[model samples]
Target: MKIFKYLILLVSLSVVMTGCEKEFLDTEPASSISAEQVAETPAANEALVNGIYANLRTYGVGGTTAHTDYGHRGITAGLDNMSNDVVLNNFNWYIFFYNYTGRVQTSSRASLIWNTYYSVVADANIVINGLGTLENRTAEEDALFGQALALKSFALFNLVRIYSPSYIGNESAPGVPVPDRLTFDGKGRGTVQDVYNQIIPDLEQAVTLLEGFNRSSKQQIDQSVAQGLLAEVYLETGNWAEAASAANAARTGYGLMTGEEYVNDGFDNIGNQEWMWGADIDSESSTVYASFFSHYDSFLGGYAGALDGYKLIDANLYSMIPETDARKDVFVEAGNEFGFPPLSNTKFVDATSSFEGDYLYMRSAEMYLIEAEALVRAGQVDAGIDVLVELVSSRDSGYERPALTGQALLDEIYLQRRIELWGEGFAWFDLKRLSKPLDRTYEGSNHRDFGKFMFPAGSNEFLFQIPEDELNSNDNIGAGDQNPS
Candidate 1:
């Protein structure tokens, strides 16, 4: 059954020729064909690209768990557990991630993340490389080619971020191998700078190519998506001005959601104007136990809130949210109706009790936060504060722009970011980039295991080891090349 499922996914990768309607890529192909053979026509090429998006939600890489809707939710859960913001109240599937145990060079989760992303990258390369074979290229073809590049860049961007050290003074550090084409030959690790160099240009080209192309659905990548990704890349590389500019470019057509909309709605709808990129999980196509809601949703999830285990928001951070802030209501306070732990999150729930909920990949609010952070880092303190005030005031009607500067102002902005983007998967990355220590020893902390409570800044546990399979199979990477255990 597993092999049959994989075969179906592989065949579907080349069979995306449905029609004008923007729907999920759930159509099974009549037969299998090589990716190169699949991109012969414009429709075929477009389908191939669409399949990449579909592959994100289906069984592969992060999607190994049955019915787990393994794409963004799987990645998000793992990433969030690695940080201090979200805590596991009981031993669950993600307990290893929460404790940073079993994340060794050979761990299955690490391997899944590595392999699944590379699979996307490999298919994307086929589409990108095959674009030149077309006889008469149109804007659509250019857009397809552009989307392929952007997707490829996105996969590589996340891979490098997870597998390598921060680019800050760590440019020379060993990073994941930069694969430009689909091949089995082993390639050695490159420097962290090498991967960034590749990612930046690919996204820049994608932004240019996708300029006038109309997308069938929000699931598809557009100019704004490329720009948003570029902004994040710039922020990671410490290119403050470019990050701010790219963020503003990405925010052109989107606006922040009203406080009422945020609190009342379960955040399962991708149609919300605040969402920039997302996976629209149709009810019929829902992956029951494997879906995002099954894991993250308080009322609907299998592991969180009123379920087998609980997902708790960091108590210290929760205390920082002012009562005036509407976002504070997203989490259930201790002694609330749910009987959940203090600061247990209720931010995500399926509209019905079912596990069918759209998974958000990126949002406009992230862009606003990125712009603010970039501006502040670039020495435009007041301008940055103004941007933040604009966002915060919307969530907290009584918010008065606090008088803050220097590190204090930066800290405040970071705090707002944590509150605004919690569970959306920024916590771990932020902690790593800021070189912050993980200390879960505070009062009311949910992390009870002493052995896993604190890891200092620059600890070996910060980066995931290259999968043991890769080290064993690839000649370029060996045991010595593994991240510190």
Candidate 2:
């Protein structure tokens, strides 16, 4: 049952494709088959691109995946053990508590994540390579190239962070399998530097491709998306000035949502088209709920608003949030209705008629926060603190966290990020990037630690073990592909 549950995520990945086939035209168009035949048309290209997004919701190895949603079990449990949050359930939360030897195989989540990231990249590759072949490529084709590049870069960036440790001033960290922009075959593990190198080029090209390209709605990636991603990259690389500038640019196009808008109907996500980038979910087409299969949804008794005691928010972080903030509602917490639900962490699961919600990849708040953080990091302390204070003060009403700078301001901003971005998958990413410790706790959370890490800050607990299959099939890597030591 332990391993079998992982299969559920894989099953979800398979269904992301629109299985309904469209019959070919009855005409005599058998002249030849070209890559353009698949992507030159909007419908075919859209379907191809959609397939990648669908697969992205599966579990593990980075960025956006079903793991973000499903990990709630392991995550809730893991956090609970460390005292960060309270677990509402105990079904199987202990799996992560210790390290053990198990034959490695590619997980549905890892492979799907790999496939999604690359397939999307491949789609972008197709856009890059097939543009000339396309019947009417035009500026839209170039815009897609930019979108594809940004998407691929984002996925690669996340994949690298999950599979590899922080740069740590050394270049040898075992990053995930990095693929060449032109290949379709699976490659072995690339070094952290190798993976990092691939991203900047793609993003740089994407920025160039998306010059002046603007398409509203977070579902479609455009110039702003490119800028937002670049800012994130710069921040990660410690290029504070460039990061701040890029983030500020993205902020120009978007910013924090209004109090009411922040808590949309129930889809309670940063996406919902307000996203700088996000997944478009169709109830019929997306079985996100099936993969999520959690108590946080409709069954728990009301996590955010109701719960079954399956998951909760971190106590430390939870305590830090001011009472006046409207964003505080994002977490239900232990004392809310029964105290078992702990913190709500419902920033992503915004479903009114259902327990599910449309997911977002990036949002305006992130851009705003990035700009603020970048400014502080770049020595623009007052400028940066102002940004953080504005957002927090607005959210918390009467609260003001002081004009903090250095570690204090950075920590302040990060806590809000965790609270604001919790459940949407940024928790692990942030921890991994900053190399923090995981310390989650709960009454009945299912996941446990590999060793002694707590809730949301464990080492590889932040990253995932590379699925074993790739190592066997390719023989270029090994069982424990990530979270080294």
Best by TM-score: 1
Show model 1 residue runs off by greater than 4 Å. 1-22, 25-39, 66-69, 132-136, 182-184, 450-452
lDDT (0 to 1) per candidate: 0.78, 0.54
- Weakest lDDT window of 10 consecutive positions for candidate 2: 20-29
- In model 2, the runs with Cα more than 4 Å from the true position are 1-33, 36-47, 57-88, 92-112, 132-137, 260-274, 291-295, 298-309, 333-340, 345-349, 440-463, 478-485
Q: Kindly list the per-residue Cα lDDT of model 2 for residues 227-273, writing each as its tens digit.
A: 88888888887778998888877767555666565654344453443
Task: State which candidate has the highest lDDT.
Answer: 1
Estimate the TM-score of every prediction: 0.92, 0.76
lDDT per residue (tens digit) for residues 319-423 in model 1 = 899998999999887689866776777888788677768878999999999999999999998889889998899899888986988889889989999999988
